[model samples]
Target: MTVKQPDLSFTQNPQWIAERETHWGPIEGFLKENNRKEVVEQLKKLFFTGVIDNPEDVREGFAILYYPLQTAEAWDYLFQDVRLNPKCFKEFMNASLMGSYNEKFFLDDEARLRFFDYFHPATYQPVIKSRVPIGREQKIVQIEVDRFEILRDMAAKFSQFLGGSEVPVIYYRLDYFFSFLDEACDVMDVSNNDKDDIQYFANNFLQRYFKIESDLEPKNRGEQKAFLVRFYNHIANNPVHPSIKAIWQKVLDEHD
Candidate 1:
């Protein structure tokens, strides 16, 4: 049987949202009033019977069903049919990463690492690229770095699981690395000697890994600072060579 494609255009449609809420209103009320166990059994039957077809509807149902419950057991129940209902898994991942779901459904470090273990090498490139520049306006390099670090750490811990496949080197830019250092120095009272040491280390590291040289001087301090803040934050959060972390720490230690 040919499955009907989900109507993605309805994502922002007010009419569709109203219809969805209307359709789910009764189920939501039932879940709110009844014991979770009873609701789970009833929903499990409906889920298995293939009553739901639209991805958006399925996403909304999962949210309503799981919102009241806050345990892995509940998540597993919702995920039981994930293989049969792949859209649920996709939407769940999207919701988790986009912060649409509450903390109860958040994918912690271990869960995220395990989740990415199954990804093909081709999938890593776009994932890294899309995540690298998440918070440019915040002007906090460390925060942005921490976000990307999640993916970077996942890549490292699951290297064996990934069969030692590499994300494209193009995604790792040296200028961005220098920009991070530049931003770090701005906030921290880094000595010229320390800055020189960091520059040397970064230069050699880039040469060794990417076989390229980076211009450490900021052409436009404001623009570069913002860019570097996001870039550095990603590096700080993720796994890197021991020297990189050591140098970053050294710079940070001199902060006022």
Candidate 2:
């Protein structure tokens, strides 16, 4: 009788291979479809939470998402002009004068130079002339918060040079005048409801620190008109304010 070999065939097991292939197919398809959306969501989270420094990543994510549903031209058009405030110098200067600790001290030389170029004497004279720092002592304090350090430092320097307290008074006036600007610029982007809430809290909080009576008073048309006139006068006579003016001039001259 002929010997018979035992039959063994595991290679024909299509069931095992079929399940493995099926498991990965859906994952690959999902990644292909939702990659852009996932990137956008991540970028949004990063930006809103302050995890990212620049908005460039968010723009790239947008471009990726737009490419599938939009034309190349359309995608380019959406992100072609990406311009943020190059230098928030005015804001810095205003905050410093207002006694609010903003990021003025941290800015580099390039940013400072750009700031002067953007708001040179010729361009910003009218604005400076309109707003004048009030000389009256609304309040008195020995120590101010860090934001006013720039003005304070400048005043101290001026005192050393001039041998009197004239510059200190000017710094005080400039601080008061710029505080209004700081508040205005801060709330510009906030929604009406959010602004109202912020204003309510700020008005109450500021009352404790400042001598001014009413913070809730709306900036009406008449008040604005008069304030503008005073502001221009102040800017025109900025030389009277020793510290900030000297620093501004120095920065300007450096640029020149």
Candidate 3:
């Protein structure tokens, strides 16, 4: 017996995309300001009792849902008594297929798959036709979620490096390190073990390689710069683990 495939010819509405883009800018600004309480309150109101009249509201709602600083307990509390319209929720999800920023941290692959399936346009086959095949859509979402998980891990590592102090210079180094890792991974096949190794190296490199003490601020700007210079030079001269060495070489090659 031949099985029939679902028709998936309809693309996301361009109007919805425009509306989401417009709403996203202000929402991003609000989150960047780091007004946690205000953001939380606004999200609670929006999620619990607010009306989502269009795709823009859905985008705004998702922005709140995906904010990085929100803890699991906070999300649980916010969603506890919330009542969502199934139709609107489906529309919101279909319009905002990028999912949440912190989705990987908040939900595992299975949970995310469940989310996608729940809000799947396939359910409303007569009303909507997905431009993406359902199987392919799952893969796309998974890949996007994996990227988010990498970013989430990078943020966590940066926080660990911060260790309660606000230092701008360290952030630049953190960005550089992660950028190198991203670039290197793109150029080479990396396993989970390789990723773990890279992260381990990153944590140690900040303290041991750069000689930046966790509890204390750098004593001198010149010394910190000197340390970075020496570390880079050492890596350039050394034969390291293939995975890590590739990252170092990539960074050095870019600088050169």
Residue-pair clashes per candidate, as listed? 5, 14, 0
Tens digit per residue, CA lDDT, model 3, 12-87: 4566445445545555566546656545455434433332234323432353254222332332222222222333
- lDDT (C-alpha) at residue 167 in model 1: 26
Q: lDDT tens string, model 1, 32-131?
A: 5654654545554343332334433333445323322323433433344222243334444433332333333222444433233322122323232211
As a TM-score, model 1 comes out at: 0.24
RMSD of model 1, in Å? 17.7
lDDT of 2 at 240: 39
For all candidates in order, the CA lDDT equals: 0.36, 0.32, 0.38
Q: Which stretches of candidate 1 lie over 4 Å from their true place?
A: 1-56, 60-68, 82-240, 253-256
- Ranking of all candidate structures by their lDDT, best first: 3, 1, 2
The 10-residue segment with the lowest total lDDT in model 2? 129-138
Give per-model TM-scores: 0.24, 0.18, 0.26
